[model samples]
Target: MNCSRVNLKNNTLYKIALGLVVAVSISACTTEPTPPVETNELPCRVAGYFKSQDRVGGFYRCVWNASINRWIQYPYDCPRGLEFSEQLQACVKP
Candidate 1:
């Protein structure tokens, strides 16, 4: 009789431990994943004072010139068949 009681208690304890482990696993799988962070850096470009051109042959953009402590704009001329790419910071074929 005592042996039978001990077996029953052992089975009950095993079932309870199994139930706890399953519950923990399910909760872990259901958690939400972390989101990606955003940044202000431009793609295919470096962070510094520089110039870039637009599709038209006339428009241009210049960054702050630390040496002179001011912003300066320069006239940039793209090739007849190509335009300036701000992302690339150079003239590229359209």
Candidate 2:
């Protein structure tokens, strides 16, 4: 086997590994999620779904994190042309 060819193959593998490492690290880190209310607060004391107090067609979910022993709120939005129906507790066309 030619030494130069072997060196080039090793270099290509090294670059590929480095790229994968960077992609994984970036994906592992979470950015701050969007806030749902003017005060940027959610009463996550109870774990379940909650309506967004500010925006129309918006909602959020309160999930229990056993590792932290607390509730975390994740904001979501209904699909375009739909709104969250608090009465029905689901998204509906308004």
Backbone atom clashes (below 3 Å) for every candidate = 0, 0
Question: Judged by lDDT against the true structure, how good is candidate 1?
Answer: 0.56
Where does candidate 1 stray beyond 4 Å? 1-55, 58-68
Q: What is the lDDT of residue 21 in candidate 1?
A: 100
lDDT of each: 0.56, 0.79
Deviation (Å) of 43 in candidate 2: 1.8
Residue-level lDDT of model 2, residues 1-94, one tens digit each, is 6999999999999999999999999989967876543336557787666677876778887877799876777788899888887678898999
What TM-score, over all chains together, does every model reach?
Answer: 0.33, 0.51
Name the lDDT value of residue 31 in candidate 1: 53
User: Positional deviation of 71 in candidate 2, in angstroms?
Assistant: 0.9
Model 1 — TM-score against the truth?
A: 0.33
For each of the candidates, the C-alpha root-mean-square deviation to the true structure, in angstroms, is 17.2, 6.0
In candidate 2, which residue ranges exceed 4 Å CA deviation?
1-39
